[model samples]
Target: MNATATFDPFSPDAGTHQGGALDGHALVQGDYGTAVLGYDLASQVLRDKRFQNSALRLMEEFGITAGPVHDFRARSIIMLEGDPHLRLRVPLARFMSPVTVRNTRDVLRRIVESINADLDDSAPVDFYRGVAQRIPSLVYCHLAGAPASDAPQVQSLSERTLSLLTRDRSLTPVIVEAYDELFAYLAGLIARKRAEGLGDDMLSYLISLGDEGKLTEQEVLTEATSMLEASSVNTAHQVGLVVWTLLRDREAWQRIVADPELIPAAVVESLRLFPRTGVVSKIAVEDVELEGTVIPKGSDVHVAVWSANRDPGRFERPEEFDLDRERNQPLTFSTGSHNCLGQGLAKAEMEEVVRHLAEHYPDARVVEDATRIGQAGGRWLVDRLTVHMKP
Candidate 1:
């Protein structure tokens, strides 16, 4: 809108642009097409169906022009719109609903405690590997009714498949192979569920839906695959990010320790500051205009979630952690019809992890010298996070 602000959001130093306006414009154009940099504009673009997810195109860019992987991406829930999208999204939403997440709290707490039990708090530890990276897959196993023994493979597959989001063309082969293994793994799990008879888990529910004609066999597999790919990796990093953020801010950590009821808000504030998926790329299906800029059809429109979350126009002290901040809705999980269906479960999982740390390791502090947290390709990644649980 203002001189077509120019900067690459994917650059390693992209994080340098975390203010209300990028070059005094909420929407700017560059070689990467348009970037929505303000909260209001980002919200509008995310909800507008005319702007579709660019994941399918991204796959093609990586040379996955045709095949099962491409076909699946083409039909995945993120790429769908209207009635077709609802049909796929509704089934998964039922499992991640507020009631279901509330019911899963006890189980989440148990899983967190079990994972922490093996950690020796006598010395500083790599919290990222020891705790953050491990919880989500176990949670997935619980939801899908798979054996807990399958958690490691589930975590690995999710990580490799979603690595495509890193926009690394070099990971094309790894992405394809990961999806193939994912499909096979889901098929085997589905078959095993059938042999054991249907259970109450999400996968069993999908299988029953297929048997009842509510979904086709392939549709069932697609739904399961969608759940599996999205189940682990992001949440794991986010868990580490939240812990890293909370522990580093002694005031906030102390507040959370004093009142465990503040854990949820504390987690939200941390999410705002260091969202894992900082960029949500979309494509214009038809000509679209925003803030005086016309995005031609088929053009890329990257929503800079990291920038929007810290927009001084929307946040009082955009860079500071404020647990009492009202209506603190960050696009970390996104917003709109296509917003994360697993967000409730993910938040519950994070909250429980923080709660466990607060109650058991109140004196915990981040060992910053042994930690590495940075941004790349517009995503916040945790390379290492060391914490002295008893210090």
Candidate 2:
């Protein structure tokens, strides 16, 4: 059945009215083209090899430039497939190894401490700008071996690129400019690292790999920029949303504060309720049958993570934010080959920040009603989360 309907996937009510797996999936006429929206179907599409991350190509097809923005994406691991995908991902796996995680924990803890120390206690603080926005950039930049001085500039460029990437619109000159600036920055960063000799950090690791001929200079830049983008972009918004979810819910906050061990579970539940990266798209390489519907070859299918995470069939009382939910699996990170490579780092950032707040500000609560902002790209972001806490 082909039903052409316009949908505001980015709307504040995007997932609230959705219930059950059956209701989660639908074919809607989107601004770019047709899109598939549903939990079970979206999960399947993500895991299916036939459904691929070809959005860059699709954008080009729709008259977007194949310039620096496209070049970076094409070279980045995100767009690679099959052997090339594995080849790019293999060495990078070292960055997320058990040893790396253990090493980064202290850095993350310190970042939380620093951010927390700068905030005023009694007045309502804009957590989104003051705290959440700073964590990802600082943590990821520290891990990437980039100089602290470079973060503000890199961060500004990265945010613009991310916004352009996720939103649905014609590519504007501004985004293209961001890509040019970012490419130059990453390239220059690599050159400096090579001149100074390599260190053990991710940037230096990639440089070493390039010297050994495992990756080309362009590929190295792609990898470094990919890490910068992954580590700095979505995670900040996720951190904010998760914190909002817990603090707004008194019971959930208390549970986490009482048992610090429950912090991880709270993070998971927050992801389920309000996934920050709400939608991911894939192109069907061949005709695919999903939930009694046939998605034709070349079709652009949008996997709505926001709807998927809240499917009633997948979770009991899907709307309720229950930290103790027994089966709390979420597709916020996507799945299959293209699943998020920075999941571990992102999780660590979320857990550490939430744990710090729970311990230090037990009585903390959102001072004003939070506003939900929707992006044209189907992202549900928390606009301003003002929280009242004791010093």
Candidate of highest lDDT:
1
Q: Candidate 2's error at 356, in angstroms?
A: 1.0
- Tens-digit lDDT string for candidate 1 (1-391): 3527577778898887765577678887778888888998899999999999999999999999999999999999999999999999998888678998888898898998998889998999999999989999999999899999999999999999999988889999999999999999999999999998999889999999999999999899999999999999999999999999999899989889999999989999999999999999999999988887788999999999998999988999999999999989998888999999999899998999999999999999999899999998888999999999998
Each candidate structure's TM-score, on Cα atoms with residue i matched to residue i, is 0.98, 0.92
- RMSD versus native structure for model 2: 2.4
For residue 215, give model 1's deviation from the true position in Å: 0.8
Segments of candidate 2 deviating more than 4 angstroms: 2-12, 22-38, 61-63, 166-171, 370-376
